[model samples]
Target: MAENASLLVELLTEELPPKALRQLGDAFAQGLVAELRAQGFASPDAPYTAYASPRRLAVLVKEVAAQAPDREIVVKGPSVKAGLDADGRPTPALLGFARKQGVAVEALERMQDGKHEVFAYRRSERGARLAEFLTGALEAALKRLPIPKMMRWGAGDAEFVRPVRGFVALHGEAVVPCSVLGLAAGRSTLGHRFLSTGPIELVRADDYEAVLEREGKVIASFERRLERIKQGLAAAAGDAQIAADEALYTEVTALVEWPAVYEGHFDAGFLEVPQECLMLTMRQNQKYFPLVGRDGRLLNRFLLVSNMQVDDPAEIVHGNERVLRARLSDAKFFYDQDRKQPLQSLVPQLAQVVYHNKLGSQLQRVERIEALASAIAGLLNADRSLAARAARLAKADLLTGMVGEFPELQGIMGQYYARHDGEPETVAAAIEAHYRPRFAGDALPGDAVGDSVALADKLDTLIGIWGIGLAPTGDKDPFALRRAALGVLRILVEHELPLDVVELLQAAHRQFPAGTLAEATVGEVHAFMLDRLRSYLRERGFKADEIEAVLAHQPTRIDDLVPRLEAVQRFRALPEADSLAAANKRIRNILKKAEVVERAPKAELMREAAEQALFDTLLSLGPQIENHMQDRRYTEALSTLAGARNAVDRFFDEVMVMTEDAAVRDNRLALLAALDRLMNRVADISRLAA
Candidate 1:
């Protein structure tokens, strides 16, 4: 093995896609380090740093060996008995094996086999050179990159995420000779495309980042570059708040080799439009960071991340402002044109929009949503009129010019247009809030009206799509059914709505035409919803076993899942939890063979002393637990059930459950079944046994 030293590898390329740049760089570094560890050239604990920029991807690892360590080689030959004759001399088998190994028969050693001795050869094998092995490793890593599209350039038959401009691989201070993607490894790489004086020379592996930052004028670390932009934004925005957008920040970091923050402004007339419209234009069109005042509203000023710095940035700021002016003008035009039509008037235009050929037009879907929303609102005891009205107008903005330009602003534009059309505040708020919690960890609907409308909107899509057998398969959820199911689950649980999942699903299905849904459609959708519920609970910090125990009973009211999970969590902490869990499992097994749970065990039939004692204790405990349970006191009920552990243990220990007498055996089985039923009312206790 060679001495350990720092290693650096950089692949200079054309500008990478900004959004996926960080992910690609991180994956490349991770794959490279993992291969090094598996090949015995780098320790798992070795420190490493990944460097990514708009123009290059690089990784630096500390304490990487130049070659893998040599290992002892063991080669097995034929069994000793098969290789030897009656005289214990080498036979043809041994001779052939020795010849294949380039050794004589006498040089082979014999060792005991399973039923006989086996001939084996042992020797030292030199480890492969890192320079040679890394060629394949680099190729494998490139092949495994998460590039959605690979492009080819200039007729070499090599393809990559982008065209490869330069490739450098260095171990310590020496260049590890290798070729990747048809480019030979070298120690020279270019600096900034516009600002560089000449090609930057990398003398040592450790000098890669320092040389790039100083001579190349590049902040090579993605994270450090992001921090620079954040600090720069704060400095430029002063007391005003920059929009709290992590994704936007990360994207801008990937677009610049060196970052310079500058403040720009737009016409105060554009401020008449909604801030969402203006900010969306700023972010999506220009990648500019919009500033918000202390009142949580947008200021006229916006921050821009420049790739280069000049002593006089007047032209840069003026140029950005000029670009933003035309962008905002188009947005203002869309908003003004959208408001020219009443919100309700736009509803007819949706008829021309095809939602799904198998389902119906968008207008028909909206009608279903309106009906479902009113039903859900009635169940939730909210204003049904407002919910239906919100559902009616939710898709109206999809016809608007603003949404046509920026599809992400569909619900947001509906809210603006609804208010402009003089709709009720409740209805206007619901129009936008209905799409709340659009993604995981997002905020849910703002109130009961929003919740009702949101549920109806999601279920309309889910039932309509699933009825046609177009539900998500594998990762191909074109309809986002999983997201819809999770949204429904989050609404019910987070809002503490007392709606039953099955009833809601059945109600949603009823709005469809007769026979439009499969016979098992409701059941299938409910089960899928339950599956999502289990995962949602786990994400909220519940244990897997706790969630499984609660889900086993398949409670219809998802709002009650948390209470059951909490009770199970408390049950696990009890002193008798293990015994109760084991006992419940035993009771389940016994009852699995008998169906006499409803047949009351006759008091006179309990002949065994231990059985009578357990029966008497259950008489007092079951009713008390049932009383607390009727009041939804799950914790108290479970705590009360814990008191039955000693009686249960004694019953199993001293009583023969399968007495030969017919009446006694039936009564014993009945008693065990009754215990099992009471214990598992909140959750299937057997799952806790795991």
Candidate 2:
């Protein structure tokens, strides 16, 4: 149990799903290493390396013990009162407890447990063997893999992402006997299915990668494979760019065990299609890295990540080119067929494509989007017809042959077709840009018309989806409503637009016919949108309580929120901020407890000098604060209100609001209520009080 040695484990299988192979490899390695550390077989500082190839998942861990050390355990039994019966003779509870611990009744000691004396048994439980614990760990790690679909092979009960081919577990040079997925563990593995020089018999734990690369013709490390691919791409592309994309690189790394880059080319006429379309075809469909010129346009050449490093790549290059030519031919066919009809002609066909059963067809959704975009354009002083036209044609491309083949090209193809239809440049740009900020950290639309349509389109989705109670729940957001909400907030707050989110929700939902979405949902949707805005503000580094203070006023204009928060922050730092905040809180409590009394304080009843002084200050500062607030200079307004701190403190110190005289008490209450309103004009600073 005290011995320690480096260990290696590998699960060699058929080719794994490339997109998720990296994630699966990491999860398996971390889960096993964590289990070993938790079971006391692995040191806290033990290092491990994860290896994922197209056919295998493996981990090499250092300093793993053969077994975990024994530990003491305390088992509690019945309380003393329950254990003793009559003359304190050994009762059934005491007898049974001693029998379970395999000790005499006299050996059971009594100890205080939770205010009661209870019998307890203490002993050392033997540590577990690594060979015994490893089977469970290996099974658990494989069971937890992120496999979208799992299948069983050869009528076996074992299930995995792919069919099991091999399972290798080694402790240094010794084989750790275990069974996984119907395969006995051993220090053996297969390399490249086609190019392996010979069978690999691993003699040592640390020689896995080296042996695989030498005799088995495979690079075992996922990272090493990525580096090899990157270096090979550089050499193959020369001075030209390889059109680098991380996702494409990762997938390619997962697809090959030994990478060798081969260059292929298609006819220059295929470049007539938009570069984005061509690039997507190569990257998404073929998994090829398209070469781009210095001007960022796709060239006729592409690079393939072939798994084999053959003596002659002439035949491989020809085969890749022949395959790519056919792919490009289909792409050109779709492009030519799509341009035959104007983009607008596709609008009538959308009526047949159901957007959602509850929301009717795509044509109906477009009508709602068109109206909302037009309204938004009016508020932004943009050309209304351009926004409307863009919204009308935005979804038309959904029916195009090009877009039907590649759904990702919906908006992009819309832009191209809009231009081909001789639409205004602004409208054409808007058609594509309306879906901007598609994901988190993505850019917002560049043009005014684009912004208008983007906001309107996202708002329509949020309002309709939220109105029908189909909003996101827990981890499930089938409609992506949360993303839609955040997009709406980013457009409003980040753009500094003064549009009221609540009003936009109302305007959007109203466009839907009766029973489509509840009219009563206006308030709920407003609160939800504000919550997204709150999260957005926190990400920008605003304090939580400060945001709460400003939001209490329900400010309609998001552009004014930051200035209001800054004004409250400035108010908190003032010399009188603490005293005024305390007095405001006290006034709020008093008003809550007091009965309905809307009457103003009588001037004749203000006899006390402290009360009179507070009133005079408020009367003088009233106009100044009002003027500053009107100009949206929130900081200046709150600064003017801070002048009342001295008077407010004095009044609280020298006067008591709950007096025996009824008339005087009402007057004091009225004065406090009036002061509270003026101080909170910008924000509810009372919430900021300590």
Candidate 3:
């Protein structure tokens, strides 16, 4: 056994990519700890802390051993029977193995390997010392980091995400003798770029963070720095809400070592532009957090996280304000120039913009979208003219200066520009909503008109992209066809629209040029959408079998999918559900094998008492199930079918349908066919069987 002590390792480097800082730190810490545990240098459950800043990556591990424990080593050789001949004399195989181990044949031990006794060499092996193994572990951990690109500094062979300036490797109160990235490990590390006076020395492995904060004027822990920034923002926000997302906060946290939040403001005139534009410039370009009033409007003031803290920070605040003014001025200029002309005038420019070489230009795609939107609007009983108008102008904003600068503002800028051209409210709203539900958990289109255009846009992309042999295959959907399919499914299922998905696909296919798409494209895309629907339903908490039950029928009208699934759930809970489902499964298997012609069950053919009784019960339940199904009362229909479980069970147990009489067998199969049809009207209950 070796003495154990805490360990610290840090890599001081140039400024890292802020967006990847957190992930880099986590990977560095976890990778080092994993290698340490694997090499027996640290315990399985050792406590550790990861420290990451813009200029450094570090980890502190507690209870790391200076050396691994010694253990026994075994090397298996020839089997006992082979190693010894009839007179128990050592054979050549055993002699060779013993010679390799540097021992005599009699020193070999015989042990059972599986069922056969084998001759083996056993010895005690010394454990490795930390100083001998630490560098290798560090190299392994660095090799596994998720660095997208590696750079070499000063023409050296060493390569890392950034130029490495220093390395720190400490065990307890002593510096470990190790080297990495062509740099020797030391106890000294630089802190803040401007605030700290000189290199900070760590006297012990445990004092890394404390000394960095107190003397070096830097916060080593990423999480602690983030919390401090959050507290400062909340205190400075007063009544205004901080209009920042987690991504912004994380990036800002990575940009600073000792974060100090400062308030800055822009001219009130910049607020005249859409708040989305202003907020995008501030957050995306400047890394600033904008403030929003209670009324959900952007305030002129914004908060910025700075690395330096001063008693009077007027210079920093004014400098940030000045920088933001230039960005806002650019946004305002784009907005002003974009509004000078109506959005419709830009539609013709889409002719030169290639959507895809296989699929026509943007102008042609817009034409297809326009026609499909009209057709979908007619199906939803929405304003067809409005849908068509919205679809025609949707891609027009792509040519605008505002949208060109901030591509995220494509649809949103279209809405503003549409309104400026005095377009109808419904048309403008539809133009924006056509791109709804862009990502998971986003909102769907607001109205039927919007839904119509959205479906058209997504359907065109899915059918067109898929028709050209670019369907999503093993996570290689460069065109995001999977997302488009999900968007279409969400619109239909969530809105409860009575549109047939296949019919919609056909309508979209018609808009394409003749002979451009394969004839089977419609059916293929429909099947793909159903696969996406299964995943979507599973995420909504439906059981796999339950989803299969509803989808087994391959229902083309998917708006009723949820209702059918809900009914199946209720049916599954019935006291007789298990036996009934088992019977249905048995029936399906029997019918699959039976060779019979179409015919109703003849009264005279049903000879057994149990068979006749089941026939009567099915007849009585037929009208009730039909009425429930017709009224869309799927739960009631399944409940009504459950009433025949006793008859079904009795028939299966007593009936023998494969008789010498062919007519009787065919008639019995027909009876079962009717029963199967009624039972599966809502869903294939057989899938629920255990």
Indicate which candidate wins on TM-score: 3
- Tell me model 2's lDDT, rounded to 2 decimals: 0.88
- How many clashes would you count in candidate 1? 1
Predictions in order: lDDT: 0.89, 0.88, 0.93
User: Per-residue alpha-carbon lDDT of model 1 for 1-690, expressed as tens digits?
Assistant: 237888789999999999998999999999898888888889989889999999999999899998888878889999987898999888998899999999998888888767777999989878778888888989888878899888899989999988999999989888889999999889999888777788988999999999998999888999999999999999999999997589999999999998999889888889999999899989988999999999999999999999987788899999999999999999999988888999899898889999988777899899999999998999889999999999999999998899999999989889989998899988999999888778878999888999999999988877878888987888899989999999998999989999998888888888888887777888889999888887888788999888989888768999888988899899999989999999999888887876564777779998888888888888989999889888889999899999998999999999988888988899999888788888888899888885
Using Cα atoms with residue i matched to residue i, what is each candidate's TM-score against the true structure? 0.94, 0.93, 0.96
lDDT of 1 at 408: 93
Taking the tens digit of each residue's C-alpha lDDT, what string does model 2 give over 291-397?
99898888999999999899899999999899889989998999888999998899988899998888889999999999999998999888999999999998999
Displacement of the residue 5 alpha carbon in candidate 2, Å? 0.3
Model 1's TM-score against the true structure: 0.94
Ranking by TM-score: 3, 1, 2
- Candidate 2: list runs displaced more than 4 Å: 231-244, 310-312, 569-583, 599-603
Q: Candidate 3: worst 10 consecutive residues by lDDT? A: 595-604
Residue 253 in candidate 1, Cα distance off native in Å: 0.8
Candidate 1: residue pairs that collide: 80-117
Clash number for every model? 1, 0, 0
Listing every candidate in turn, what is its Cα RMSD in Å to the true structure after a full C-alpha superposition? Answer: 2.5, 2.5, 1.9
Root-mean-square deviation of candidate 3: 1.9
